[model samples]
Target: MRAFIFPGQGSQKVGMGTDLAAASTHARELFEEVDDALGQRLFQLMREGPADELMLTENAQPAIMALSMAVLRVLEKEGGVKLADVAGCVAGHSLGEYSALCSAEAIPLAETARLLKLRGQAMQRAVPVGEGAMAALLGADVAKAEDLAEAAEADGEICTVANDNDPGQVVISGHKAAIERAVAMVKDDKDRWGIKRGVPLPVSAPFHCPLMRPAAEEMEKALTETVIVAPSAPLYANVTAEAVSDPALIRSLLVDQVTGRVRWRESVLAMHADGADHFVEIGGKVVGPMVGRIVADAEVMSVQGMDDIEALIKSI
Candidate 1:
C-alpha cells in the first residue's frame, strides 16, 4: 500500500517551483489560478526572491501548496497517475494538511490557497515578534521532553512539547523564557538521558502550543465560512494521528492543531500499522528521510521535480 505525504514549512526556498511551472502548461495553469485567487503574483516571488518577503508565513503557506499541487497536476496529466488510483492514504505536516486536502479533492485549490493565506496571517498575528519562540530537542524522547516542559512550566513559564517528530526528535514551543528554561533542562539531563543539544527554530510565533489559541479561534471562524468535504482518501490529522474523513471532525481538528501537538511520529506508526509499505513525499525532500527513520522497512521516495517524478514513475 502507498501513502502520499505533503511537507510542511521550512521545506521552502527561493525558486522552488519556477522550473516545474515553465516545464509544463498544467503547472503554469496551477500558478495562474493561485495568482488569480489570491490577487497577487505569488509565483513571481517564489521564482525570483528578495527572500525575506517570500519566507513570511503568509506567503510561504500558500506558495508551497501551489507548487506541490502544480507538481501533482503535472504528474497526473503527463504521467497518467490518477490521484484515486495511485494513492491509498494521504497526510501532511502542519500547513501541508491544507495542501493534502486540496490534492484529495476535499477542497478546491483556490479555496485551499485562500484559507492558508488567512491561516498564515492569523498565526503570525497571534504573537508579537521575539515574544514567543520554538526550539527543537534533538535526541530526546517524548517523555523526557514532556518532563522538561513541565519543569519549565513550574517556573511560571509557558512551555510545552509541540511536535513529536520521530523517535529521539521532539520540538518544544511556547514563551521564549520557558523555551530557554526547557533547553537548559534538556542540556542538564543530556549526560543522564543521552540527549544532545536542543536546536532553536527560526519562526515568528510559538506554533503548536497554547500560545496559538488566538490563532485557533480565528481559524474556527474562517473554517466555518469555507466548505470542506469528505476527502477522497483518509487524512491522517496531525493532532489525532489517526485517519479522519468527516468534514466536521476535520474542521475541528484543523482548529485544534493550531495549539495542539503535531503527532507526526504516531501518525506514521499508525499508517504503517494500517499496511502502508511505501511513502511518497511530495513537494519537498525533508519528510522523506524522516519517514525512513520512522518506518525503516518502508520504501520512501521524495519527488521534487520532473526528474524526481520520472524516477518515481520508474521505481513504481
Candidate 2:
C-alpha cells in the first residue's frame, strides 16, 4: 500500500512551480485557477520574486498549496493517474493538511485557497512580532522535548512542543522569553535532555501552541462557514495522528491543529503500521526525508516537476 503526503511551510521558495507550469498545461491552469481565486497575480510573484513578499505568511500558505496541487494535477491529467487509485491514505505536515484535503477532493481548490489565505492572516495576527518565537531541538524525541518545554515554562510562560517531526528532531513554540529559556536550558545541559542543540527558527509567529488560541478561534469561525465532504482517501490528521474520514471530525481537528502539537512522527508510524510501505510526497521534497528517517526501509518518492510526475506514473 502507498500513502500520499504533502509538505508544509518552509518548503516553499521562489520559482517553485515554474518548471511544472512550463511543462504541463494542467499545471499552468491550476496555478491560474488559484491566482483567480485569490484575486492576485500570485503565480507571477512565485515565479519572479523579490523574496520578502512571497515569504509573507498569507502568500506562502496558498502559494505552497497551489504548487502541490499543480503537481497533483499534472500527475492526474497528463500522466493519466488518479490519487485515489494509488494512495490508500493521505497526510501532510502542518499547513500541508489543507493540500491533502484538497487533493482528496474533500475541499474544492478555490475554497482551499481562500481558507488558507485567511488562516495565514489569522495566525500572523494572533501574536505580536518579537513576542513569540519557535525553536528546533536536534537529537531529541517527544518525551525529552516535552520535559524541556515543561522546564522552560517558568513565570506562567507558554512554552510547549509544537511539532514532533522525527526521531532526531522536534520543534517547540511559545513566548519568545520562554523559547529562549528552553534554548538556554538545552545549551546548559544538552546531555541531560539527550539533545544536541537548540536552534531558533526564523518564523513570523509562534505556531501550534496555546499562544495561538486567537488563531484557533479564527479558524473555528472560518471552518464553520466552509463546507467539507468526506475525503476519498483517509487522512492522518496532524493533530490527531490518526486516520479520519468524517467531515465533521476533520473540521474540528483542523481548528484544534492551530494550537495543537503536530504529531507528524506518530502519523508516519501509524501509516507504516497500517501497511503503507511506499510513501509518495507530492509537491515538495521536505517531508520525504523525514519519512525516510522515521521508517528507514520504506520506499519514498517526492514528485515535483514533469520528470517526477512521469516517474511516479511509471512506478504506479
Query: Which predicted model would earn the best lDDT?
Result: 2
Native-referenced Cα lDDT, model 1: 0.89
Which stretches in model 1 have alpha-carbon errors above 4 Å? Answer: none
Candidate 2, position 188, lDDT: 96
lDDT of 1 by residue, 1-316 (tens): 8899999988879998988987899999999999999999999999998799888999999998998898899889988886778888899999988988998999999999999999999999999988899999888889888877777875566889999999868999999988887778767877754569788898988999988988999999999988999998899999999999999999999999999999999999999999899999999987778898898899999887999888877776
Residue 56 error for model 1, in Å? 0.7
Give the best candidate by TM-score: 2
Give me the runs in candidate 2 sitting further than 4 Å from their true place: none
